[model samples]
Target chain A: MKIGYLGPKGTFTEEAAIKLKKFEKCKLLSFDSIVEVLDAVDKNKIDKGVVPIENSIEGSVGITLDLLAFEYNLCIYREIIIPINHCLITNKGVKLSDIEVICSHPHSLAQCRKFIEKLGLKIRSFQSTAAAAKFIKGKLNYAAIAPKRAAKLYNLHVIQENIQDYKNNFTRFIVVAKRDHEFTGDDKTSIVFSLEDKPGRLYEVLKEFAKRNINLTKIESRPLKLGLGRYIFFLDFEGHRKENKIVDVLDAVSKKTHFMKILGSYPISKIYESNSLKK
Target chain B: MKIGYLGPKGTFTEEAAIKLKKFEKCKLLSFDSIVEVLDAVDKNKIDKGVVPIENSIEGSVGITLDLLAFEYNLCIYREIIIPINHCLITNKGVKLSDIEVICSHPHSLAQCRKFIEKLGLKIRSFQSTAAAAKFIKGKLNYAAIAPKRAAKLYNLHVIQENIQDYKNNFTRFIVVAKRDHEFTGDDKTSIVFSLEDKPGRLYEVLKEFAKRNINLTKIESRPLKLGLGRYIFFLDFEGHRKENKIVDVLDAVSKKTHFMKILGSYPISKIYESNSLKK
Candidate 1:
């Protein structure tokens, strides 16, 4: 069961893909875009594909959500939450003061803004954290804020480890499989829906979840692109669609919502606790 | 007065600052980073600064929101909403088929992924939309997807216009000034706060706004970095705190919330409904 994911290698996605030891001896194929990863899964180019759905620092990956909305048949099989640790890496013997320009993925750089400001270095953005390490390897007098694995992969030296401005950083990744596997009974369903442009419409939808006592973990809206007043909501609730209550909630919600799609209800990851360690 | 914004002279911020000309004699200052714009505002380096707060296409500009929360004490004095119109551009005499590699700001590139894939070119990322336009000026083999203004500013010809996959694309920007101004009466307040991590904590805080019928425009959570489970919620609501009802709502929220800071409240920009066209 070979798997494809977003990568040029050494990205957090690659890390998450490798952790899936169930498919041992399976080849790992990396693609440049999340859409490509999804297409690969849809076409059976890869048995599974992994993409970051949310980050503790960045919130939901809008493209991932957009992809979910656009691609109708793909099912989410499993979810993985990976702890993100960023490091400041540079060419050997490069001192902080000697550096005038720092390059990294924008999110990584943002995570260490205070440290960069304290050092007074200019920042240049790269496409990915691993790509930043690659940029540093080809240049001198620059540092990259990236994962330590990136430093190792790109043959750079770590100037500082765990340089993320905040501790307990993590990114949530969802595994896209061709079809939904048997549920483990304890699973969460993720859905996206759009409400008509009217007051109390959204409240009424949420009222269903609340009245049923179905705990909602998240609710986010994106522009439906129709106009200023229109929006689509993405909701995550702690129950499997296979459950009777969830089925009723979806059935009622389907009638009220202008557009609704159940993205998937996969077995919750084994790691349920939010393990953010305080420094 | 000169208002510097994050831009290459023709990005959305540039467009918004130009639209603000009726309210003030505005000179546009383009900076590479929003933090730089914030720093300039803090040092009185510029009379005002406009930067993107959120985008319908890409979601929240997390770095901008983060800077508002932690690094700067600037107040939002005005708001500007710009409709996003992406165009594919290249040097004169260049055709789409002539391009082998494409470059743009990541979000821009991502927005135009469908078109780029249909054309089947390698897409590279640059720091900003304008920078990509500038880079393509001397490079014959690369084209860029950027805002319409960027193509005009950099003297590049548009290969294709309005190429975004979604028709309902818009970005909201805020004009930041050093001192807080009197509320416009018809205004909005933005604040960032953290709550003790637990299930339903977010729902409880949002309940405050929902109960008051305050109509929150946006609510997003960023890791607080205090620990793994903690989060800071950034909220945009319909009314200013200077109003008695809003003040009471805020007071009630502050008591129940662990940490809170009111970033600013000023007149929500009427830019969305204006007749002003991009010059």
Candidate 2:
């Protein structure tokens, strides 16, 4: 199967994509923009595409939500949550003090702001952490804050590791395919809907999920841009869409909401199991 | 009044602070981070502070919201919505086509994503758009995307002007101070609250605002992290908290909300004739 993700071969998204598949021969394709990655999956350019949905430290990835709203046909088929560990990587012979300016993705820089500020070096930003590490390997005066795996891939030396502001820093990525899947029997579903500009409508809709014992994993609201008095709600719940309880809950929600779109139902990701290599 | 904003010389936030006051000796102080700027105001280290709250293209500044949530003693006193125009800047004599990579703050880069993608050049992120312009002016083979004023400050050549993706791009900055000011009688108020996780509870709360004909300009949410089922809503309304209608609405809605906090109320920003000079 052909898979697409955001990458230049060593981004966290690439790592997550590779981890999602078990087959050795899965064809992996990289795209620069999230829209292109989604388009590739939609037009059958690729069978599925993996993109980041949210980051623990940074909150939700707004672009992903906006795209789901813009591209109405795509559905999420699976979910993966990757533990993120950022490190300070530098060229072979360089030390931390040798660096006058450090570079990395904007999110990474923000996550490690205190540590970087304590070191008194200027912060720079790159498109991705991997690209920053690659640049550090080529330039002696530069150091990069990136993942440990990226440091290894680019042969850069690690000056510090696991430097994020929060210990539970993680990014949730969802795999999207053109057609819907049968929930893997044990799955979760996501949907976006808008409440009429009326009182108690949101509480009533959310009550359906709570009463059914369906736990919500995420909820966010974005402006409809039609001016004031309009909003759209994106939600994630911990149950399969095909389940009777969930179906009934959604049906109840349909009555209360002005517009509702089911983004997808897919297998829920298990926590990552680190590799155990045998000598 | 003494005011704190960001500056070394020519930052956009500095320009905004200057426009906030008419007197030449308005006691302007430059700070480093959004937190620092806000803290100075909360601690009464300064009379007030001005910081960018939202941009037309980039949405809300997440850091500003986070700080506001923690510092309940401070309130939003005023707002300044500034028009933003980014230019492609490089050292003198460098042509646009000659640059292989472009750099800017992530928000700036994202705002111009479509245009940058059309140019088909790699995007690099930097500390800030102004800093990126400064770096590009001192280096080669690079162009920085930043406000036109930054290009002039750094002695860089503008290869292209008005390069943002959206023409109507504007950034709304809020002036924050210690408490709700005694209204000169025409002002705006901000509040944040959470609803009981019941359907129609939020709907009921919204109705109070609607019934009173209060125009809400913005509404945003953040995870309460109180675990599983809580959320906090940030809101901005057109009238001051002291207005009879607004006071009645707040009292009527207090029964429906689980928690409510008034962020403060102050005079709405008046039209500034000098803001037109930035272009």
Candidate 3:
């Protein structure tokens, strides 16, 4: 009945956590860092924890992926895909022309680069979006680039909405628990593996999935930490581990590589595709 | 002749530029940003510009790769690989025990996490390693985690050398020019392409290289900037583009992908592999 999220309360992760299934009866707690939230899940301190796995604009969240691959023993319970909409918020009664400076998290500022560049205002990076919103609560000339939820939470006036550089901007969040969700009939499985230092080894591994007609939703590589050119490949494919075809694909893949880990099986989010969020 | 680097001087790029072929005679000019340096090369303001393309621990530099692919018309002229060694530097006669804060660029600070955690000192992030070194010049009880070259340039004492968590750390720097180098007989080719988003499409493209006995030195994907799950693939292989077999591979690959670009060919660096850097 308890869930954890990366937060000082008003973050995208918190927004995703709020939308979890049957959240009306659950309690939510905020953790300062992603690792802390995941660690809490691993230790049973929180029933589940939510953290961002990837961004449409920024790509993968390297730290979250690294923790799941190497540091922690947890499986994804569910996924929540939401559109990342950044709005410019300021103190009440402040006109757009009155704003002399803007502030937000580095990622937010980067996401709204075009809008900020056009405004020709000095920008500063604060710790979080909500924190910035709170900092500019009583200030007339400063604005915060954050979400509409943050504006509501901080009692700020919304100056503009959806000011990000890209309209299709979205982030994929994963809920991690001690064990993965059971067969949902329609699910996605995530796995990570590394191959020997040889040519075509990756091609050989992909052949297993291709031959079985398995659709890989995502494919990425992270530095294996030994040196350059050495990577641990991460793949997300459609189908739960309980499925017969996936079992065969997993068996064939395990034999070809040196190391592999099954991160989880969870139901595909409704907003998994960028176009799905469109009206 | 003039060579440009990403710098205000006292940077790893500056060090790599100083060691560039016949560089003792070439005048060096420092640019404020990576794109500016590459833009200078593209505009013929500088003969060539040096920028970090990849790091053994951090993976690819996306901006450099993207600029070469879509924004600018430039090619790889040469590659310089050097070990990234961070040292704890302090103002003259300052002792390690007297240091209350450490400072460096965010990447450098992240690279030396274990060392910083052991010291248990407050940390600050600056614009660059050399900039941080300059900031602590006459301030007692302040130290900078920067390269040894920065220590020398800033007239600071090296309290300790090779203080990074990973000693095998190295960065790959590429020289960009208006035209790529002609065949050195032993050269490498780099290319980027985007697929049509179908199952087994990537596998089919890799088959072109595999069947032809082409050894892909590096393969990575960057977000195509359109949305998530869409990527532009980059490949580095062991032959110049003008080579017959590589030409055939490119011909075959061009048919498989919607778009492709040849980033260029240059002689492979001597320290391309981490193990080769061993004394």
Candidate 4:
């Protein structure tokens, strides 16, 4: 099997892809951007592609949600949740006190804002955390905020571990393919819909799930770009698409929406057991 | 009056601030970051702070929402919606064919991506659009994606206007102060709350507004940072807290959520009338 991921290697996405590889041995391919990986998956160039869906701290990855909603017809085959343990990495023998500059992706920098502020250092943003890790190779005065694995891969020493301001940081990734997975008892169904401009339509539509005792896992609203107050909602609920209750709920909800699209139904992630090893 | 804005000057936030200044004269002080501006308002260092709350294309600004939900005690006093018109700015006498590089904030770069890609120039990122405009001064080969106002402020020339990928882009800014505005008859209220982890708690809370025929303008769910599937909801509805129906809705809704905070109530923006001249 062939699987693609967003990478130049040594990214959290790659780590998630590697974990997915154990379920079934597959050749892992790295793509430059998230769109490229999803596009490759959609065109059958790769069997499946792994990309981040949401972060515990950052909330949902808007581009991923938007693409899955409007641009792609792909289905989520599996879900993976990984801890985002940012480490302070520097060149060998470099001390934390000697570092005058910090570098990382903007999100990583934002996540570690409190730590950086206390350190009183200048910040530089790289396109990716892995790139920042690689860039600090011979720069003794620069420390990077990246995953610990990147430190080992890039031959850098980790000066401090788990430097993110919040200890509970985690990113949820999804494997997308042309078609979704079959019934998995413990699964989640993702869907997006736009309610007619009538007040309370959202409340009425959500009642279908509530009345059926279907628990919602996530809910997000994105502007349709038509204007403010105009929105399309994306939701994830605890059920497989093949389940009878899910079918009934979708039918009821669809009737109340101007339009609806089922993005996917996939098993809930259980990667914390293995991710603990890295932490 | 003293007001704070996220700026180095010549930014969209400053543009929003200038529009606000028309209603009542105020001295606009520039801050390095969103947190600083909001923090200043919380400490009463400034009478008010103007910060971007949401973009029509980018959705909600997570930092702004997170701060209001968790850290700060300030209340939103007004709402300002302005059209985001990106321009291709360069030094005077520079031709389109002479440009070899493009520079701007990441968000601005992403918004004008298609235009830049068509031009096939190397991209550079700056801390802000205003900074990028300043950096390209006297460099004929470099073009910056910024607001036209910046071009005038920095004595640059606009080679092209409205270069964003989408034409419907708009950003909503909020004026935050120690106290919220008195009801203007036509106003909107914002609130954030966490539901009590029940399967249907959200539906029940939303029903309070639905039953009263109250219209919701925006609904967003952010991760509580406690764990996956845990969320704190931020909502804006079309009524002031002073309204009888709004008071009843808040009372009913508060009884359902584990915790709740009323962010503010203020007049909705109608800045399109004034912003059209800039567009």
Candidate 5:
């Protein structure tokens, strides 16, 4: 088996990919961007790909969601949730006062805004936190906000641990493949659909799930980009598409919606169990 | 009067602030971050603040949304929508082939991803697109993805215009103040609320508006971050809160909700009129 992920190694996406039981014996490949990973999967360059979908604090990763919605013909095969802890790391002999600028992925910088502001240092954004750590090697007057593991891998000293604004920060990642997963008893069906521009069309569509007692796990709307006030909704519900009840609800919804696409049906992630070892 | 906007000047937020009819004769202040802009408004440091809320291509600005939901007591007074156009700017006499690195705000970079990838240049993220243009001053082998105004403001040459992936890209900006606006004939009411963890609670809440023939313009759910699968929804619908029909709907929803906040009702924006001259 071959699996692709966003990396230069030591990224949160890499950590999530490693924790997957099925990928334990698979060959791991690293790509520079999420778009590349998904493109590789769509073109069969790799068997599967893992990418971050959303962060508890950062909300949706727009690139990931947009790719799945319009650009890629892929389905989510599994989900992974990992707790995020950012650290401020510098060269072994460097003191905090020596740092003139801090570097990290833009999201990491945003998450550590409070701490970064307190330090009053200039910020430079890199492609990833891990990339930021690697960039600061042998460089003077520079530090990075990255995962704690990055400090060990890059031979840097940690100035501070858990510097993110929120302690419960977590990121959700999804494994995408050409084929969708089968029912796993405990599953989530993800779909993106556009409603007709009538009053209460969304409310009417929600009734399909609500009347069937299908609980929604997530709901997000993205602009259609045709104009203002136009949107397409991405929904996650607590049932597999293969389930009879869910199929019935979808069939009814198909009649009401202008367009609908089922991204996948995959098992819901068991959080803490796979993450316990990391702590 | 004084208006606060995300700035270093030459940002989309700054443009939005300048277009406001109420702020035509008012002084405008630029802040480093959206949080700071809102904080200034909350503390009466500015009479009003303009911040980007959503983009046609990028979706919601999570930081802006999160700040309004928590840590602040402010109401949206007006909305401004402006079409976004990115330009590839470089030092005078520099050819496109001379560029070795490209810099811009992450969203600007992402919007021009195809162009940047085609050129095979290294990308550096800046706090704002305008900041990236300013950084390349007297520098060689660097190009910036910024607004066309930045090229003229910073004495750079526009190598290519409208380099973004989408031609119709637009951003929606909101003017926030200490108090809400009075009803205009045409208005939009924006609210954020949390529902009880019941299966049909969301449906029950939507019915409050739907039964009254009210139209919903937007609906987005952000994780409460208390745990997995918890969410707080931000909704925009037609009709002012002062209307009897809308007031009754709010009363019904307040009862079904665990927490509710009315961000405010304000007049819908007229697009293109203010943006026509910028083109």
Candidate 6:
């Protein structure tokens, strides 16, 4: 098996991918962007792809969500939730005062805002936190906010561990494949749909799930990109798409919606409970 | 009167500020961050502050939403929706082949992904699109994806205009003040609340508005940042908070929510119709 992820390596996505039991013996490949990872899966360059869908502090990863909704004909096969512990890394012997610039992915930088502000250092954004660590590995007077594993991979020293403003920072990653997963007892059905321009359209749609007591885990609206106030609703509900209740809800919703697409039905991820970095 | 905006000048926020008739004679102040802009308004350093609340393509500005929900005591006085047109700016005599790096705010870069991908240029993120233009003002080989006004403001030439992937891209900016505005009958009330974790909790919240036939323009869920799956919902509905129906809904929602905050009720923004880059 071959699995692709967003990386130059040492990213949290890679960490999550490695934790999956099925991919223990699989060859892992890294792509620069989430789009590329999904494309690889679609093109069969890789058997599956792992990309971040949401961050606890940063909310949804829009690019990932958008690609799943419109660009790729892919389905989420599984999910992995990893605790995000951002570490401040720098070249050996580089002290706090020597660091003039800190670089990381924008989300990581934002999560570590308090630490960055306290240091009064300038911020630069890189494609990914691991990429920032790789760039700053042998450099002096530059630091990176990256996963702790990045420090070791990039031969940098951890100047500070768990530097994010919030201690419970976590990112949820989803494995995407060309086909949807078979129904598990505990699963999530993700769907995207657009409603007609009318009052109470969304309420009517939500009522389908509510009346059936089918709980929704998440609901997000993205602009349809046609114009202002035009939106496409993305929803995650607590059931597999094949389930009778879910099928009925989708059938009812489809009749009311202008357009609807089922992204996938996948088993919900178990949260990472270990505080230690090792799995 | 003085208006604070996210700027080092030539930002879309400044354009929105200038369009406001009431701020015609007001001195405009530029702050480096959204937090600073809101802080200035809270401390009376500026009478009002203009900040981007959402982009039609990019969705909600999470920082702005989070601040309104937890940090500041300010209310949204009005909203401004501006069409976002991205321009590729470069030094005079520089050709596309000479461009090595493209810089802009992350959102601007993402909006122009198709154009940038075609060019295959390296991307660098700045604090704002205007700042990227300002930084690349006299530099050779570096181009910026910024508002057309920034090209003129920074003495750079527009290599390309309307470079955003979507032609109808727009950003919604909110004017936050220390107090709320009087209802204009055509007003929007924005509120944030967290429901008790249970099945049908959000459904219950929406029923309150639906039963009254109140229309919700937007609904977004952001993680409370404490952990995954714990979310605070931000809702925008078509009624002023002062209305009897709205007041009753709030009373009912308050009882169901673990926490609740009324950001404000303000007149909805009139979309800027002219496309000539002039107010």
Interface RMSD of each: 3.3, 4.7, 1.8, 1.2, 1.4, 1.4
Docking class of 3: medium
RMSD of 5: 2.0
The 10-residue segment of model 4 chain B with minimum total lDDT is B270-279
Candidate with the greatest lDDT versus the true structure: 4
**What is the TM-score of each predicted model, taking all chains together?**
0.88, 0.83, 0.89, 0.96, 0.96, 0.96
Give the runs in model 3 whose Cα sits over 4 Å from its true position: A21-24, A89-102, A115-127, A131-144, A155-158, A272-279, B21-24, B90-102, B117-123, B135-143, B155-157, B272-279
Question: If you score just chain A, what TM-score does every candidate get?
Answer: 0.92, 0.92, 0.93, 0.96, 0.95, 0.95
Interface RMSD of 3: 1.8
Residue by residue across A1-279, what tens digits does model 6's lDDT show? 899999978888888877765436788899999888998999999999999999999899999988888788899888889888888999999999999999999999988887888889989989999989998977798999988888888788998888888877889999999888898799998899999987778888888988899988888788788877888888988999898888999999999999999999998887875343465
Local distance difference test, candidate 5: 0.87
Question: A135-188 in candidate 2: lDDT tens per residue?
Answer: 777788788987777877888888787887666677778888886668566777
Candidate 1: list runs displaced more than 4 Å. Answer: A22-25, A91-100, A270-279, B178-185, B196-214, B226-231, B271-279
Please write out the lDDT profile of model 5 over residues A1-279, one tens digit for every residue: 889999978788888888765446788899999999999999999999999998887778889988998888899999999888788999999998999999999888988888888989999999998999999998879999988778888999898888888766888999999988889899999999998889898888899999999999888888786766788889899999999999999999899999999999999987633332263
Best by DockQ: 4
lDDT of 6 at B240: 94
Candidate 2 overall lDDT versus native: 0.75
iRMS, model 5 (angstroms): 1.4
lDDT (Cα, 0-100) at A87 in candidate 3: 84
Q: List RMSD in Å for every model shown.
A: 3.8, 4.1, 3.9, 2.1, 2.0, 1.9
Error of 6 at B9 (Å): 0.5
Tens-place lDDT per residue, model 1, B1-279, is 879999877676777777888788767888878888999999988999989887776677878887888778888888888778888889999977799998888878777778888989987777788888888897889998887777777888987878987776777888899765586778888888876545555556666776878877666666565433355778778888789889988998897788899888878765463222344
How well is each residue in B1-279 modelled by candidate 2, as lDDT tens digits?
Answer: 789986544566766787866533678898877778887887788988888877755566777776787544678877776667677888888876788889887888877878887888887776567777877766778999887677778888888877987666667788888866678676778888888775445556777877677776667776553432356778777787777899998898778899888888877665343243354
Q: Give, for candidate 5 chain B, the lowest lDDT window spanning 10 residues.
A: B270-279
Docking class of 4: medium
Candidate 4 local lDDT, A1-279, one digit each (tens): 999998968788888888886689899999977878998988889999999888888788777887888788999899999888889999999988999999988778888988998999888877678989999999999999988778888999988988988878888999999998888698899999998998999999889998999999899898776767788899999999889999999999999999999988988887554253364
Question: Which residue pairs in candidate 1 have backbone atoms (N, alpha carbon, C) closer than 3 angstroms, thus clashing?
Answer: A225-B168, A276-B228
List the global CA lDDT of all models.
0.78, 0.75, 0.83, 0.88, 0.87, 0.87
Q: Write the per-residue lDDT of candidate 3 for residues A182-259, one digit (tens) a residue.
A: 997889999999999888988999899888989888888877877777888889999999899999999999999999
